[model samples]
Target: MTILLTVLGIALFAFGLLFSIAWHELGHLSTAKLFGIRVPQYMVGFGPTIWSRVRGETEYGIKAIPAGGYIRMIGMFPPGEDGRLEARSTSPWRGMIEDARSAAFEELRPGDEDRLFYTRKPWKRVIVMFAGPFMNLVLAVAIFLGVAMTYGFATQTTEVAGVQKCVIAQSENRDNCAAGDPVSPARAAGLKAGDRITAFDGRPVKDWATLSDRIRDTIGPATLTVVRDGKEQVLHATLAKNMVARKDADGEVVPGKFVPAGYLGFAAKTEIVPLSLGASVDRMGDMIQNGVESVIAIPQKVPDLWNAAFGDGERKADSPVGVVGAARISGEVMNLDQPTTNLVAMFLMLLAGFNLSLFLFNMLPLLPLDGGHIAGALWESLRRNIAKVFRRPDPGPFDVAKLMPVAYVVAGLFIGFTLLVLVADIVNPVRIT
Candidate 1:
């Protein structure tokens, strides 16, 4: 049963991935058609064609490899400097450039002269290229906000889960109280498990964050108004200064960081709680920022990935995951001993994270990616505006085809890195368990 469930989860993720790829390509296709660019091929996945059908000017199809997808726009590059498409060359580098140029013009129909992609204005071209990544971004934000605002997240509440027997500095790292340790303030003040804190000192406490902040800000006397057995009670205690783990804005402890703060010596209860639209937006922003940082940190993680795959080293929890690794995680998530709703939410979150990664990854301004084309268009716009201001001749569209050689190198490096990650994922896969 577990194995079957794992396979089902993997299959579900595969479907989600295909849908994401199709959605991404649909953005480019729609925008390109809207701008009157002639698209000859709209393909999901790469490698040999599995199935296809020609519809009007476009050939829509699915390919054998399910990794990535693309839509081939006619005359993606402008003609050469001489105002004519260059002939095939025998030199290797020249051949690379010519092949790309030829592919861009492969299905060029007679009327396509005006329908060529490069014939569009620079800003329009930017929109056409940017649309793909933007689709993924939209999907990510929608999923994240849906799960957060509708279903809520597991969050800390002001109710006490447990009270400490004695005060122990977090730096000490041991929960067991020593014989000479001071009695915990909460215990001494008659605070018990299941006590719901209604207020702190003179301030009304609506949530755990408010109460925690108030407790941390004071080192001496504080008043806690609690509700227990449907009755309210006020308790007084002297908070002690102690080394404690620092928490982030999300109320999660920052690993390896400690600070001196007033200690209350009790654990806050956690509950599944929904968030407001503003809070949801704030969380989405944080996710985007973290996603950017994770993408930036990929190069640095290569060594660790290599060690984990080939050596006896333990795999780091933050290790980069490929599709295979992510699918495996999805499988594990499905098999977790949790409620069905929680499992479904986890799966949706996984898909959302994958979409976010796709958005961030393709936005790197390097060749063969959507951002690379967008960058070229922006540069062309910049240069043309400068020429217009100086009353100079129009420079025309930037010859992005000239960057074919560099694009080839970038593509090769990406392929190599992907293979490395594949090997690592198979050998030392990251697990939710």
Candidate 2:
């Protein structure tokens, strides 16, 4: 049964991935058509055609490989310097440019001169290229907000989950009390696990963050008003200075990092609470920031990934995971001994995160990606505006094909990195512990 469930989860993720790819391509197709450009083929995947049909002027199909998809826009690049489409050459660099130029006109037909993608204005070209990544971004935000406001997030409350017997610095990383350790303030004040804190120092405190902030700001003594067994009582205790996990700008505790703060010696209870729109937006911003940071850190992680794949090195939890690893994780999540709603929520969150990563990854201004074309269009726009101001001749559309050689190099490196990640994911997959 577990194995079957795992397969089911993997299948579910595959469907979600295919849908995302098609959705991305749809953005390009719609925008291109809206601008009167001819798109010959709209494909969802790569390799040989598994199913395809010619509709109107375009061939829509689902290909064999589900890795990625594309829309075949006519005249992606302008004619070569000789004022005509170029042919293949013996020189590899020249061949690269020729290949790109050739592909741009592969589906050229009657009346396509005005419908060519390169013939469009630079601003319109930017929108056509940017629409794909923008679609992924929209989907990501929608999914994240839906999951956050529906199934909700586990939030910490002012109710106590546990009371420490003695104060042990968080930097020590040990929960058990040791010899000569100072008695915990909560324990000394007769605080119990089920006690609900109503106020701190005669001020009403509704949530855990406010209470925690007030507690950490004090060093000597504080008053806790708690409701125990239908009776409200005030308890007094002297708080001690101790090392605690430091929080980042987002108020999330950073692991293996500590700072000196007043210790209350109690654990806040956690409950599933639906998020407000403002709170959800804040969390989304934090996610985007973290995603960008993770992308920037990928180069540094290559060595670690190589070691984990072949050597006995431990795969850290923060290590990068590819499509295979993500699918495996989805499978494991489905097999977890939890409620069905919880499992569904976990799956949706994973898909949402995947879409967010897609949006960030494709926005990089490099060749072969959507951002690369957008960058080319913008550069062309800049040069044309400068020429117009100086009253010089219009510099023809930027030949994006000229960058084909560089795009090939980038594509090769990406393929190599992906293969390395695939091996690492299979050999030493990161797991939910």
List model 2 lDDT by residue over 1-433, tens digit each.
9999999999999998999899889899999999999999999999999999999999999999888899999999999999898666899999999989998998899888999999999999999998998898899899899988887889999999999999999898898888999999999989999899999999999888889888988888889999999899999989999999898876779989999999989999999888989989988888888899999999999999999999998898889888899899999998999999889989998998888888888988999998999999999999999999999999989999999999999999899999988999999999985
Candidate 1 runs further than 4 Å off: 248-252
**lDDT against the true structure, each candidate:** 0.92, 0.92
Backbone clash count, each prediction separately:
0, 0
* Quality of model 2 by C-alpha lDDT: 0.92
Model 1, global lDDT: 0.92
Error of 2 at 8 (Å): 1.1
Model 2: worst 10 consecutive residues (lDDT sum): 246-255
RMSD of each: 1.3, 1.3
All candidates: TM-score: 0.97, 0.97
State the displacement of the C-alpha of residue 323, model 1, in Å, after optimal TM-score superposition: 0.5
